[model samples]
Target: MGVQFGSFDSICETAALVICSLVGTAQGIEPSCYSRNVEVGGTIIFQPSTSFVHIVAIIMTAIMIFHIRSKYTAVGRKEIVMFFYMYIVIELLAMFLDSNIIPTANSSYPWFAAIYTGLVAAAYCCLLINGFVGFQFAEDGTPLSLWFMRIACLVVFGVSFFISIATFKGFAGFSYSKPIGLWIIYILWPIICAAVYVVSQLVLVFRTLEDRWPLGDIIFGAAFYTVGNVLLFAFSVTICDAIKHYIDGLFFFTLCMLLSVMMVYKYWDSITREDLEFSVGSKAAVWEVKDPLLSTGLDYSEEDTVSNYHGGGVAPSLVGGVSGQQLYQKGGMGGRGYPPSDRY
Candidate 1:
């Protein structure tokens, strides 16, 4: 049942109370979605389905990294590629956390979870920053822009890490029972970042680009992201029960998240183009062919004049003043061109 805010005297007070309740309520601690029956002296595998999804996400992220790197001339390549790297890290940590490979009782769980939380925050922060690259607020792909993004992500990661560790370890008066800080860092922060990124990208597309195809990519990404989170936070338990514990929201959530990331890549690739002259890929060569007979009003330098071909023996009119058509006439021994030696 949902909490009734109607009883509260004012909206501000109701908001305050809700915020207070969020403390020590690390809601990520949910029931295991599914587990496989594996017994080698009886050890049940936990959330194997979700773990498999994590593995797939990792592979997909690596593929995205390769593809993004290949676009050497694309704007914001370095900055956005960093997001996928962090994502890979997050998924690796999640595989261990969700699968219970790192047991909850393990003393390192809180530390690892804190690191994971921080990385997730950093990744989202990176995405939010990247959304503005098209605005040329600073030159994209420059060291200045790259470092700015790196430092911003680092600061966000550090703050998120502190909050998470404080909550998990019950330090700095952060109670394990009231993990509001973690809830904000882990859940609310990502949603805020995503909203900002989407808004910024929409502005970029509408205000800057002539082609609006990226809008579709943005829409698809937002849809996948929305569906993934909804499945995870709203209907995980219900789906878990409905599926007879075979799989749950986490699986679909992971899949949708992957699709969302792919859309991010698609949108970026759509907006950015390679300078083909400097591109690493092979390009067809086009040679210019000029017919000497048809060439007229051609200006030749002193070194290229027909005088050099005739060894100063031709008349002054036909020497340096010769037209391209006269230079190719049958005057020399070969009768095909002016000079038999082919100097002309």
Candidate 2:
């Protein structure tokens, strides 16, 4: 399924941003004033490349939540959302503590630093779990309910949480500056790996046209996110850290813009899950339509057989819940819209 686990909703992102803003203000989390040297009276306001990853984190989370609740609307979706929500909390809270927003050197809890690392690890685990969930969705907008998938998600979350706590408390915490655990989390077995996996799965589906999955806004967003993070990671590995602090906000801001825009103008994603039942030729010769106001995924494949309900005055749009008369056949050549009446 395209949208996180199909559409990007922004409610949670908005709420989290407001809460973080208030907290940052109260705690005096001074955003770096990169514009002070360039702009008049810039010292009084925030910079263009803001150091507020939490703001965008929540917004992205909100879109995932909205997609789960509205389109998927399944028990599995609820479970995935719950984990995803936890992931958001961990990341936002870490940003609040780890940043110079508040000095951690003389903090009451000597172990707080480890806690921050744990949060990062756990959050990545949640992200990977959601990625796995995305693969389970059937064409009909429900997950496969596969036990192995469910078990894998649970096991990873559980193990990741414990390992994160352990790594933080152990000697790894002090040497975190050149940390192996952190390196593994970000490099060898990076969180972005999940995004890569998703894109790979999508590519496979497109080529075979055997799976009915929506290539909704989430795919594009994930692709964008993966690219940004990959570039950032590569640069961090090779380059100096002096400029990263000042410009890191740009990467986060760019991701937020891409995702937010896709959420608003979701043309391809507008088509309902019903559309996935219809056939889309193939990746090489794929033909997709655009109707911006009607943004949601119309998942399809070359081998699909679409069946629609054609009755009453309520005509179904090619992409459902839209206002138009495109005269699409309710059901294709070999399909029937309704069952025969049991008059006998």
lDDT of 1 by residue, 151-198 (tens): 999999999989878876678987656566666776678889999999
* lDDT of candidate model 2 versus the reference: 0.42
lDDT of each residue in 54-76, candidate 2, tens digit only: 56666776786676555443424
Task: Rate residue 226 of model 1 by lDDT.
Answer: 100
Off by over 4 Å in 1: 3-43, 282-344
TM-score of each: 0.75, 0.45
Instruction: List candidate 2 segments past 4 Å from native.
Output: 1-53, 72-76, 106-116, 127-178, 207-219, 234-344
TM-score of 2: 0.45
The candidate 2 region of ten consecutive residues with least summed lDDT is 3-12
